[model samples]
Target chain A: MLLLSRHLDQAPNYRADVQHFLFGREFRAEDLPFSEKLIRAHVKNGFISLRPGIMPLNENIFDLLGIRKKWLCARCGNRDQEAFAFCSCARCGKKCVYCRHCLNMGIVRSCTQLVTWQGPEPGFDRAFLDGRPLCKWDGVLSNEQQAAATAMKRTLAARESFLMWAVTGSGKTEIMYPAIEGQLRQGHHVALATPRTDVVRELLPRLRAAFPDVPISGLYGGSEEENLRAPLVISTAHQLIRYAGRFDCVFIDEVDAFPFHFDPMLEYAVHKAAKPGTPFAYLSATPPSELKNRFLSGSLKGVKLARRYHGHPLPIPRFRWIGSWQKLVQRGKLPSVLHEWLKNKMEAQQQVFVFVPSVSTAAALTELLQRNGFSRSAGVHSEDPLRHQKVADFRSGKLRLLVTTTILERGVTIANVQVGVVGADDPIFDEAALVQISGRVGRSAAYPNGDVVFFHNGKTLSMVRAVRHMVQMNQEGDR
Target chain B: MERCLFCGEMRGDPLSFHNLFSPEYAPGFCLSCREQLVPIDPRHCCRLCGRDLSRLDRNRVTEGTCSDCVKWANSGRNGLYVNNHALYHYNPFLKEMINQFKFRGDVRLADGFAAELTRAYRRIVHNCVREQSGILKRKPSFLLVPVPLSSERLLERGFNQADVLARQIGAPIVQALVRVRDEAKQSKKNRAERMRLRATPFQLNEKAAVSLSGHKILLIDDIYTTGATMRLAAEALAPARPDSIRSLTLIHG
Candidate 1:
């Protein structure tokens, strides 16, 4: 009813109506978001049921013009007829066709109506800046970071997408703070998204501390934060698939990360989330070749921060010949060379991460390491229920080392930890993964240098390419 | 041309000539997604329930039977039905497929399992006909009873998966039972609670009651989890005094 809409508008903050009646769209009875008791009350009072479970309440004649009648994903603009599949929704006791493209987030059935506010928009007050100074990070940005931030802000003002080709540990998050604050001061919404949830976790505290006065919300799977309108939203890239033209400025951190680099659907989601013609700045340590070519041709805007914020060179991984590690593993013994290396690291009290190609190998290495008198080590993979706890225990100095699969290859940082990849020749351990593993080292300024070793049975092109890429980054840092 | 019945994807080798030599070959699904349907390893399974025994703790098994079956035997309901035979594991993939088949009214999916069910039917019931006739027989004097759904559920879901499966098994299907009450879906309940609820929801159809006497009955269903539904159905059918009762399920959770 119009009275209900008015009551909602009078509230302290705007509440996005997740369920409302829309004209011209065929919706099922069961997909209604409200409880049956509430629907019963509305029905009793005079609301007409269009069908068994569908309500055809009159709101505005113009609202019907914007209603999408056909089966299409309002969030991701996915119209591929084959992308939809029939699902028997428990809530709506009918055979509902759902969008399979974004099924990982949650099912969005075709017969289900995703209705937001159709009333007049609310105006946000200047109370967010009520005599409080903006851009409140106590730590000052480095000269390189400041220059990159200026360039990024300029491109945002021009309404053009730009690439921020910053190396690992280059303070990319801090560099975006100025642009976020500028956008917020102008009453424009801004979003910071990364492809990995761990990175979102690491960024939340830093962003909150940097802008303590502003209202910020973090969106990720299982996050308990309220999902209301906010000036600054920090989320994982997958969460952006649900948003629709809500942001004026978007920053896609780790643009080249897994499930986002080669995934065209995620890229389409990024575009769908941003307002038309709005700017997006892609920040990645290793930009994909497509983006790099566009930057080279001057078709896309670009900025680069070559050096680490701590003024140290990126660690170059050196290869070591360890013949038939799998054979030695089957015998319950490590390679002689690797055994000596582990002994020296343990003797020096160095925390380490031993990367393997698969979960089984990680378990095998963990067993072998423990058998070799390294009882404080543990193995972890994606399916491990205690994965987060193990990482925390390792960070708190309770564990001396960890044997992990590629799940931990990116978005994890431990201080003063040496890195080693057991099967560098495996196809799963690609050049991007190797580069990310090396980036895990030399992360903290307290220990700006560490060793990265690729203990391989034989060399592969990916291994050579990773080594060369790291060396090239270091060379550029010197300039 | 054979195609994957799940997503309608075309199989790479639609006609594997080697299949001609292998009687077990059934080109039902494409290789790209065929791994989703995980077959149960008969070697490492509970002798009584056909559940994958590898997942159970070593101390939980006694005399080649899982703890659930041991509990069932202790409850004095062991003779209600013969051992249940399941074809696949009730994994997430199978759960989704079954959900689409039953709740979503995708009746065409039942055709995908026609060959396998026919094979199981011949191995279980047809062998008896062969022993009596001294030759491969075309028909057996056995009643195929599909687990009945309540009238309300029949209206909601539009079809019963067990009926479809039994029809595909190529035997004479007999709707000899009816549900007196519309119990909530077993999927919404926990395993322990589902097993403990000893209520029988079925009653013998009066018209088919006389024929059930002295006839072997084979119960058909989609999944065998905790064995509560089939046990209750068998208990309900005991009044007719069938000679024997058995069950065949598509998946074992």
Candidate 2:
């Protein structure tokens, strides 16, 4: 066991205080905040020992607080037995079963002791943050934006959960600033969590500029801001697995986004990370139906911002028939109309986003486009390591077109860019994804409107509903 | 009903629980993921080291032995290990799997390779029974001894990869050796440095040595990289005076 301690010490950034590691929830030894020796001593003294290696200090306190068995993981929420395995754990030195569902995040074994903060509440000095305006956003908001912001501030003050069902391009990020400011003024820690890393990258610069005086940090995998214990944290939802009862308020951006919307464990993590009775808000252009139902049934308080931040209607997607796109691409050609559309967009100096269904298709289409004299065009997919640099090139106008997968469907904003879904009817492009893709076209106030085309082999209900949904929102915006 | 042990993705073609557990029916991975796993063809392997020799010219193997084995034979250390059998070529897929098993602490991955390993052990046991003649005829008895991990490495990895592999053989296992000192991981060292790493980290466990007195030993490991560890281990076991020792590894580099 002592030999194991030396190995535990080898963990990078390992701290020595069990309290820091265990606070807010239980933790595996691999993610320890304190020295393994200290934790082992605690376990030896019966202060903590659950499954085997999992040690939570002060078990009696957890019992008193009614902390139940965390059978379901707080990250990715995988409760299936298939996603778990029994192993001879070195930490516990016993046969222990660990959750494999969220293993990629870190091991979550049955005996893995999660630590929660049991001591006096962590409070920041309000005076330290005084004299300076908490929010530095000097621009005035539109009526709907102002209303949503006020409601957000009120919800934070009341410490109640709320939802902002804002449409795409409705300045959802800006709307949360006032509420975030209110929380910061009260010296409360705030977390702005989103589902994707790209959003985290996009929000970090904007948030840093908005609250320069505030110690703000962005949390994501491979993020440099990880070590910063800032009062305000902008993080991807996946990064929230390490936190426990740490935030006073958690604002989840794009609650309907992939992995977060689908994985229950992310929701569990949100509950675990936020302090008890803390305020939270779900900000999404197209929230999941369950959340919508909750809001409709008066179980949730929410606001709707239908119009774009630039006060223009969302660019409604126009469907163009292109029969058997798979066959066309396989035949080394594009649909005549779509090819003409791409040529026109390129001729007019407009950057284009051509969303394909898969990586191979993206490559094939990019090859076809390049061969057809569109030399500045390239394909970008999730597996493409150069996707970031390619996106940067597209943004700087060095590249005229980017053929991509759904990875770029959301949270990408390029001014004067025409958007096209080559396989709009493909099941992968759900209503939410289509809405997000269209939202990308008319984001910038300078170029508030651009063409959004859905070139498909056949019409599908999702496509029709997406078109109807956008036009309906545009009509609602008129009010 | 069957799912990938790693990713939890359900197999498109459902497998019964019995079939799922059976090595012949399921390889413990989904079809897409299984593409990464390339089994070493036995016909294409070196006689001594079990290294894939298909890429080498037939002339390179003199008298059914690779140049490495010939060198060891010439060095008079061929008796250090009777024969080494390995199941896989050390490919990137196996490397990633080993990473999960040894480094990431996902110990259940041991079960994924267990069935096939046990089958291989049984075949070796059968071979031993057939060649029960001369000095080998002293006993049909055998002891399974997994190469011991240093105390520090053991503490870090929690469980030894070789030990886990040996356990899957379903043979009686003994902790016959204790590591006297920890050395840098072999993977981190350059080839020359690894070749020069001659100091034996192992010492015979006196208590367990009594059990190994006259028995044939089946040394087990996760990978047969430089073959230096096995040489040192055999030298360390010389005191116990085991009649003979053979090694079985999950992979051969």
Evaluated at residue A30, the lDDT of candidate 2 is 57
Global CA lDDT of candidate 2, please? 0.79
**Model 1: lDDT of residue A341:** 85
Instruction: Please give the DockQ score of every candidate, comma-separated.
Output: 0.14, 0.50
lDDT per residue for candidate 1 within B1-253, as digits (tens), equals 2556677677665456786567655546677666788877767778778888887899999877898888888888856577777788778888888776676566556777887777777766754566565455655567899998898787566467788789888777889899989987898999778998567889989888788888888899998998998888998889898888888888898
Instruction: Point to the candidate with the largest DockQ.
Output: 2
**Predicted candidate 1 versus true structure: per-residue lDDT over A346-409, tens digit per residue:** 8999999999999899988899899888899999997898988999999999999899998777
- RMSD to truth, every model: 7.8, 6.6
What tens digits encode model 2's per-residue C-alpha lDDT throughout B84-150? 8888877787788878777777777777787778887887777788887665453266689999988
For model 1, the superposed segments whose C-alpha errors exceed 4 Å read A1-32, A35-119, A122-126, A262-264, B1-16, B19-85, B88-114, B127-138, B141-180, B187-219, B225-247, B251-253
Model 1 per-residue lDDT at A189: 76
Across A1-479, the per-residue lDDT of candidate 2 in tens digits comes to 99999988864332234544454445665576566686666665455543433322233566457654334554445665456666776555887667766666567665565544454443443554766786788888998899999998897689888999988878888899888888888778889998899999999999988888787778887888463347788988878877777888999998989988578777877777788888789999998898889888988888878898889989888999888888888899877888899888887888899999888999999998888889998899978989889999999989988999999878877788899999899999988889888888878899988999999889988898888888888888898
lDDT of 2 at A166: 85
Interface RMSD per candidate (angstroms)? 7.4, 2.1
